[model samples]
Target chain A: MRAMVYRGPYKVRVEEKDIPAIEHPNDAIIRVTRAAICGSDLHLYHGMMPDTRVGTTFGHEFIGVVEKVGGSVHSLSPGDRVMVPFNVYCGSCYFCARGLYSNCHNVNPNATAVGGIYGYSHTTGGYDGGQAEYVRVPFADVGPSLIPDWLDDEDALLMTDALATGYFGAQLGDIVEGDTVVVFGAGPVGLFAAKSAWLMGAGRVIVIDQLEYRLEKARTFAHAETFNYNEYDDIVVEMKKTTDYLGADVVIDAVGAEADGNFLQHVTAAKLKLQGGSPIALNWAIDAVRKGGNVSVVGAYGPIFSAVKFGDAVNKGLTLRMNQCPVKRQWPRLLEHIRNGHLKPNDIVTHRIPLEHIAEGYHMFSAKLDNCIKPLIVPNAR
Target chain B: MPSTPYVSNKPKNTETREELRARIPGWGADLDPADRPSYPKERLDPSATGAHWDFPERQAGAEGREHSIEHEIVPPVFGTSVPLKGFSGAIRRHAYASYSEGRAAHWLLLILGDRVDAWESHLRSLASLRPDNPVTETGVLSERRRHGIASRFGVKRSDINHQWIDPLIVGAPWVAAGGAAVVVVRKLVRRR
Candidate 1:
């Protein structure tokens, strides 16, 4: 199997490796047909997430065909098309029994303290990610969502991570009928979060991002109002003006742990380190939320941990919920929405590169070139 | 030129000073070193002067399943109790111990024990009873200090070393025996 191996910090290379076979009775081997670079993967590319082992295949978002399955995997069989979730979970466990599948105890026995996420670093579980040619899918019966024949690859890909993350964000925000929601960052997850809020009957959805293309896409495809943080000298004031000075009922920070933006654009960039999704946006969301409002965080909080202004959350009496969503829980509903034509998350795909050009895709996506939001990498590239 | 003051020689309650003396014994024995019938090394300890260290018998039934008992030391208000009354001896009817509540308390205590000082402080601040500060009994904290253990000086309970509560409580021999209370106060003093 020729797979893209994470060599070292900020370096990924296409390497030849043996195809993984099912080692456990619950395992299944999937012939990965389509895999994409996740926004979280960019964190790995830029050296933000350094815990990913060198030479480990680094991708968790994919749509694949089950080539083989162990005896225990009765629910899924060969030739079934599926969307794999980012986290591998055993259906049985204290957390799993309570429907908190992300923190499933049986997934990674070694690093068994916190939740286990696929394709993440050793701290998560050293499970080789799905970015390779043929990847081993653990807890196959629980992890993979069986895609119906009607849905295309693009639609299925969204369900794997981005769409699920967005739905998870909306779920966390508790988006109900007529609720006004504001989402930070118009990246893939943010857009999906906005989309989910719309589907959940949000009265108004506003997306905040600096990129002109992403902001425009959020308005056009995801049905969100837009705010470019770069344009407004005071984003809080700008967002407040839209919400009648009461602030939004719900604010979702899809950006997690973004370093300050230093991109020769604004003076604020100097302190922020990067012009991307960040925890500062979380602080902003807290400030921009109404009293008793909800704040849902679906952003990938990288390995970096720092101080946060929790007093703002406390002062506002805000209900803040954060977790790595169990995609399997939401995938079925998202797939139904996709099939019904009520949801079209595939419109976020701006670039589709071959698996060989994954490195190039990473560069373009990180640089925010060519209106890229979610770039799909067709590994087989037929 | 200075004469040392007289020091009292009371056997201070050194209960929480958990010492790992016994290695995991072969098959049949009480897990706790303190509860063991007797170890040869107990004769050599300076503190064991005239104190017969009677270790409990390793209670193993002939069928080979070893049975051991452990008492969870919870606050009396929180602890489960069986009322036996009439001011006279009667048939003692025992109550079934709920493992679920015990498990919950066990986890809660593990988490609470991690910041016992903060909990102690909070309890003191909230309670109507303004308990007096601990009389710094010199021998209790200082004997270990005289032996040059840095951990002996820290009054903050979180600063004390503890393994993951599960393995130590379940697999290891020691059992939690009893409880104690202390007081802490916050004050601002003017420095001359």
Candidate 2:
């Protein structure tokens, strides 16, 4: 099998690796048809994540065909197409029982913070990712859902993480009717967050980013107001200015560790390794939302102390909600949204790179070179 | 002061929905209220938020906190917990100084620092008579008593795949530490 192997930061190569066999009865071998290089993958690619060992493949969002299944796997068989959620969780864990699949206690022996995630480094369970010709999907009964006959393969791939996570971010906001929602970051997740905010009865949606291209996507795709934070003297002040000086009712921080607005925060957190991640966007979220408002954070941050505004949050009585998206939990409503033409998850996809050229794909996305909003990987592409 | 043009019910651009649809593929798919699931809840009224201030008062105590090299000043408020310290702090400082976050060395060093910090905590705990327990902390006891082994054998468990490794990875460190302690005690006893 040909897989993308990590050779330190900013270096990945396609190398032949063994086709993984099912070591567990619930495991299934997937012949990956589509995979995506997520913005979070840039964390692994840039060596931001701890224990992202050399030779580990870096992909979590993928959909594929069931090439084989273990004896205990009854829900799927060979030749069935499935969309695998990023979480590798048991269906019956304490957390899983309550629909908190992302925090399943049984899957990851590495940490208790998050459940097993495919190819997200050893810190999230060192299971190899699907950025290859084939991948071993564990807990196949729980994680992989058969691709709906009406859904496109591209849409199914995006739903595995980006789309579902975006909706989850909005869901966390608890937006009421006519509430103003501001999203920080115009990445795929951010775009989806903005889009999902409107579906949750937000009166207005605003997306902020440094990039012009993504802001354009926010305007066109999400039909939300867009702001280039680089253009403003203080983006938070600008956020308040637009929301009647009360601040937005809800703010979502979709930009995680490598946020660009603050030079010092980015340098210390991202460059210096002082903090787990840059809290610039999250800090901005706390400041930009109205008092007693909601702040939904879906951005990927490492498990280290960030300089968050804990005092202000307490003083203002802000409801700060965050978690890794329980992708499967959001699927029912999201599937309905997609069926109703409310969301076209793949519309944000700008580039399709073959598995062989994934190194180039990572470089392009990481460098922000080609207006690449969402890049999909065709694993078996000729 | 006049409000920003963006804080209006009207679309920001002059282009109509049809025009946007023409230019961008699949645009305006959710434009109609009938098509939207939450249309009944969406009032599209942006003027109702009862806000009195032009700018909120800034929170105090943001001085002298760690910030990225890119900012001129810290945000109005920032967290003041868990300032970096100890030998692990030195390793982290070196990691920041030596390599860009884009390099694998930076993160590897950070992970190494975390391990060092864990050991430091363990040593501190030992002095406090509240030492870390490998058995309970690692959930090894749960496997014996809480149907952990029973759950993995016959049921469909992804973790069963890596069960072979769970012991060596978890137990080896403790075994090595125990052996080291035994050797030290033997030397002390021989001298006495």
Winner by lDDT: 2
Model 1, runs deviating above 4 Å: A110-113, A259-278, B1-192
User: Can you write out model 1's per-residue Cα lDDT over A1-382, one digit (the tens) per residue?
Assistant: 8787654333455667878866566678899888888888866554344233445677888879999997667678999988888877665555665566676654442233445666765435456777778888876766786887788888888788888888778767766555678999888899888877765556677898877767889888776678877667778888776766667889998977552322222112212222223456777888888778999988775432334569988988999988887767666566566766667778888778787766666655654554568888788773
Candidate 1 vs. true structure, TM-score: 0.64
- Global local distance difference test of model 1: 0.58
Give the Å error, residue B108, model 2: 8.2
Q: Please provide TM-scores, in order, for all candidate models, with all chains considered together.
A: 0.64, 0.70
Summarize candidate 1's per-residue lDDT along B1-192 as a digit string, tens digits: 322112332112111212211211111112233322121111323121111112211111212111111222210010001112221101111111222212333222222222232233324434645321111201122223223233223222111232122123222211221122211112222221
Q: What is the lDDT of residue B190 in candidate 1?
A: 27
Candidate 2 C-alpha lDDT tens digits along A1-382: 9998765545577777889887666678999999999999987776567655556787999999999997767689899999999988775645665667787655554445667889887567567898999998877777888999999999999999999889788878877656788999999999998988776666678899877778889999988889887677898899877766778889999999877777677767665556778899999999998888999999999866678888988987999988898787667667887897778999999999898877677766765645679999999885
Q: List residue ranges in candidate 2 displaced over 4 A.
A: B1-110, B113-192
Instruction: Tell me the TM-score of model 2.
Output: 0.70
- Quantify all predictions' global Cα lDDT against the true fold: 0.58, 0.72
RMSD of each: 28.4, 18.5
Quick one: best TM-score, which candidate?
2
lDDT of 1 at B29: 17
